[model samples]
Target: MLAAHFDAPGGPDNLYIKEVDRPVPKEGEVLVQVHASALNRADLLQTRGYYPPPPGASQIIGLEAAGKVVALGPGADGRWKIGDRVMALLTGGGNAQFVAVPATQLMPIPPGMTDTDAAAIPEVWLTSYQLLHFVGKVRKGETVLIHAGASGVGTAAIQLCRLAGVLPMVTAGSAEKLEFTKKLGAASGFNYKDEDFGTKCLEATKNVGADVILDCVGATHWQKNLQCLNTDGRWVVYGLMGSGEIHGDFLTLLLRKRGSLLASTLRSRSHEYKEELVKAFTEQVLPYFSPGGSIQLRPIVDSVFPFDQIADAHRRMEANKNMGKIVLQIPV
Candidate 1:
């Protein structure tokens, strides 16, 4: 088996493909021959030594993958069989040609979807779905604000909000990205580099403000995010692309707005929790991707790079140049 490994934590230049031992499935796990995997911010952080895999997880960097089930471990449920097409959310190790994932994390690929596209769904889409439905508790007719609207999760969040009959507003750094969000069903988009998105969101909602706010930019946007929230609003923070320090009177602001502040990270969660999330998402969202379903949530792939070019894929994501997921096609 071949996988991308870094000599040391630093830049993309340090990454190289190396032959490694193939992983074996544990009880209740499935061995997958990976066809494709997608990039995420966590991958970059791991490369730089900022984020490490959870206890007993593979040291490989990828967080999600799509592949075919080649074998099942003892005690695995009978729902899956050899050669079933599946995608999975991983705590780590999706970069390799083969990985062993808990059967509970495996999701069947839709009838018509390709492996490359299915590879892009698990991480971003699941994160967006969890934030919107579980953490944010968004309801129909509510206005939701999403930051970094051009990101993989952002694109997914926009579409999910629309599916729930909620109005979504987004903030991006470029005009083109804003337009992209609008096409995905955002009610309004703001270029945060040029405008105060908080003020714009409030005005667009006729001063009522957004009912739920999904933010990844931590300290830099903290104050403004509070200002944009409606009373009893929920603000879910999943990442701190910006610095993590809070400089303002955050407690006062939270009390004043009656806001519910939540911090979440999927990678660090327990296996049981992830299993529950996968089950809920499989039931509620996966059907939409099936043939003849009411909605088709296609993954917006920014670019695809061959396995050997994994370094370039990391470079693209690190530069913030990609509009959606950057995929790596692993050759079998």
Candidate 2:
């Protein structure tokens, strides 16, 4: 098998493909012959030595994959058989031709959904579902202010919010991106590059503020996020696209509002937790992607790159030029 490889990485220039031994399924695992995978910011961080695969996880990069099951490990024979098309939520290692994934982490590809689309679903959709439903405990008619509104997770969040009857407000850097988010059902989109998104969000909601905030931008967004938070609101921080460090009376402001400050990461969570999330998403949300669904739920794919052009894929994502998940087609 061949997979993306990097040594002492600092930029996309350092990435290349290298032959590697394919992994075999362990107990309750399935061997998937990957057809496609997608890029996440975690891949870039790992390349630059900022993030590494979790302990005992595959050292290879990639967090999600969509492919066919080739073999099943012991204790996995009940529900799956060879040649089942599935999308896997991986801790790491989805860039290669094959990967071994826990059977519990695999979701059957929604009917008529392409591999590229399925590959885009696991990381962003599942993460968005986790944030909006589990972490934030958002209710119908509440407002959620989402940072990076045109991102993969952002796009997913928008549709999920609408389906749940929650209004979603988003912040993007460009007019085009904002429009794209609106088409996906964002109630209001703010151009954060020029305007104050927090103020815009308040105005959009009649100065009532947001019941939840899904923030990926860290330090630069901290104060504004706090200001826009509704009383007793849940602020869920997942990524640090901005600098991680912060300075200010954050605790004081949060206490004054009686708000809850929570942080979450899907990748590093326990296997059992991910399984539970997958099961819930599979039961409740996955069907929305199928044709003739009552809602407009779907995965947003920005672009698809060939596996050999892995470096270019990284460049596109690093430049923040993508509005949704960027996919890679694994070579046959």
Candidate 3:
């Protein structure tokens, strides 16, 4: 088995592929021969020594993968069999050719979807779904604001909001990204680099403000995010690309708006929590990917790189040049 390895944490240049022992499945787990895996911000952070794999998880870098079930561990349910196509959310180790994941976390690839596309779905979609439904508690007819709209999670969030009949307003860095979000069902898009997105979102909603805000830009946008929320609105923060520290009258602002400020991270959660999330997502969203389902969400892949070119994939993400997920195709 070959996996991406880093001698030290720094830049993408630190990564190299090395032959490693294949992983074995544990009880209630399935061994998957990975066909494709998706790159994520967490991968970059791990490469730079900012994030480490959870306790007992594989040190290999990756958060999600699409593959075929090759074997099942003892006590695994009868629902899965050899050669079943599946995708899974991982705590780590998805960059390798083989990984052992809990059977409960495996999702069947929908008809007509390729392995590369399925590989892109698990992390971003699940995160966005959690932000929208669980944390934000978005309801139909509500207006939701999403920051970094061109990002993988952001793109998924836009589509999920549409599926729930909620209006999505997004913030992107460029005109093209804004247009891209509109096509993905955003009611309005703002160029955050050039305009005040908080004001623009309020304007788009005719001064009503957003009922929910899915934010990744953390501290830099914290004040504005609170200002853009409608009374009793929910602001869910999942990423802090800007900065984690807030240095203002944030408590007063929260009380003034009477809004809820929630923060969440999927990677650090317990296995039982992930299992519950996977189960809820499977029942509520997986059918949308089926051949004739009413919901029409799909993975938005910006580019695909071969496994050996993993460093280049990281570079693309670091540059903020990708519109959606950047994937790596694993050669069998």
Q: What TM-score does each of the candidates earn?
A: 0.98, 0.99, 0.98
Better of 1 and 3 by lDDT: 3
> Candidate 3 residues 248-318, lDDT tens each?
89999999999998989998888798888899999999888776667788899999999999999999999
Candidate 1's residue-wise lDDT over 95-145, tens digit each?
999999999988999888999999999999999999998788889999999
Model 3 off-target regions past 4 Å?
none
Off by over 4 Å in 1: none
Q: How accurate is candidate 1 locally (lDDT)?
A: 0.92
lDDT of candidates 1 onward, in order: 0.92, 0.93, 0.92
Candidate 1 scores a C-alpha RMSD against the true structure in Å of 0.9
Predicted candidate 3, C-alpha RMSD: 1.0
Error of 2 at 184 (Å): 0.3
Task: Give Cα distance to truth, residue 94, candidate 1, Å.
Answer: 0.2
